[model samples]
Target: MLALRDSTQYAHMTPAHPCDSDDPERRFRPLSPVETCVDTCGLARDSAPYFSQHNKRYGVLTMANGKQATARRLKMADRAQQLQDLHFPGMPEILLWHRNRHDGFITIPRTLPIVMQAVDAQSKGQPAGHTLFCLWARSPDHPVLSIENPSTFAAEAGFIGERAVDTWRRRMKKLRELHCIETKPGASGEFHYVLLHNPNAVMEWMHSVGLVRAELYSRFIERLADVGAFGEIEAVRQLWAQQQAAEAASAAAQTAATVPAAEADATAQANAAPEASAKVQIALPELGANL
Candidate 1:
């Protein structure tokens, strides 16, 4: 597994958010379940390669026909528009969208690969399993998944179910409704979408949605430090402070430069007035005596 290094603290880390505990109904709602075998378990042959190809090529999978593709795309768009109306009407707009023709799925902007795994529990003569789809963007600095075999996928399933699956579903749905997922055609008649947000974008979007205070963005960065994502939160803090100071200095310089030249001319005239008067008196005395 590729770990994220905290740039500030030099510690291994992961991104985390506050877990919602208040609404049990909302929280436990049947999340988009990962199909063990699409349409039927055990009866359906493992189409892992098909899904893999879809994921690698288009980032999302969808039905092969153009009409169904168009309908799914429209449905996704409608959902996104609704989300935008509900939250994030502005800022960090969706960037790209793509889907695989072989499967009926779409990847939202900024989503990562959905890691599918066999669950420890078996389902009806078939291996019970689920997919761990990443709803949020990982820090680009972190390592992407390194699953080489099905066992690794199984291990990851545990990791994700415990840490990410629920959160992923919630956030993914929210993002989808917000139109944050961009849509486009893929090589094999599939579609692909890239999330528009990076780390900064996530911070901004969080603030936009009232999930966290603007001031908390810094603290969240610090927490990332605590989790070993960066070397130290203090270092990130210092960097941010330094950048602010530099910006302030630049703004001050620009303001100084923008001061009107006429103001400088006025000051110079005021300072020279007494000398000019004295010179005028001497010249006048000389002129009077001559006249």
Candidate 2:
């Protein structure tokens, strides 16, 4: 058997397997569990190609349709047609939200449900999740949105009773406190304009603040990874680390610059003191001789 090192350069090759070595003693060595998964447990037959010797080193497997490699690039109309055929044949294409024609849809993270649960856990008995969703729905594909009518928003968020608007406002405040949104006072009220934050980033911040439960966080991470979006959080963390390192380096440089100047000033003061002392001694001797 041939071995492929666990590297992106050889990622197209069959999952790393134990290679036949010339050393007889090591020939029977078993493959580690991680390396043996493809051979022993196996991937979905439709999704993974069969390993063969002819193309073992050179061939690349085409991922399944709707997999990460092709899903995003697959035309929206094609995807909708595929879904329609599979689930509801003869469905009118005109009714579908085809990308070429639709205009009023909002993009959202796949992990939003998990985020909603996290928010609800932090602010119990409040429709904070509903309010957050409502805000997203109202947004015009932008992070910032203006709520011109609190009463209408309250109704949309399912807040009822005479104080529905008041309840909605409370949830809105909770969302701001959780760092999911930012608000500023405007003509509408205290939270007339709202700025929505990335749900994944907000979840990360909540996790740091001890607001996210470990189990929920695990699920959230898994969902993000599934959607190939976990990198966004990691990228943010890396950027923050880079900023901190830059700040530390800048501070060190300033301290280094200041120390040299401070030492020079001290040396000048010390040298002047000796000269002043010598001059005083000379004056005293002159005065004595004159006397």
For this target, which candidate reaches the highest lDDT against the unseen true structure? 2
Q: State how far residue 30 of model 1 sits from its true place (Å).
A: 35
What shift in Å separates residue 256 of candidate 1 from its native position after superposition? 2.1
* Backbone clashes, candidate 2: 0
Instruction: Return the lDDT, model 1, position 130.
Output: 29
Q: How well does model 1 score by local distance difference test?
A: 0.37
Q: Which ten residues in a row have the lowest lDDT in candidate 2?
A: 45-54
lDDT per residue (tens digit) for residues 186-278 in model 2? 999999889999999899889767898866875675456456565577666677789999999999999999999999999999999999999
lDDT of each: 0.37, 0.70
Model 2: CA > 4 A from native: 1-80, 94-99, 242-291
TM-score for each model: 0.24, 0.59
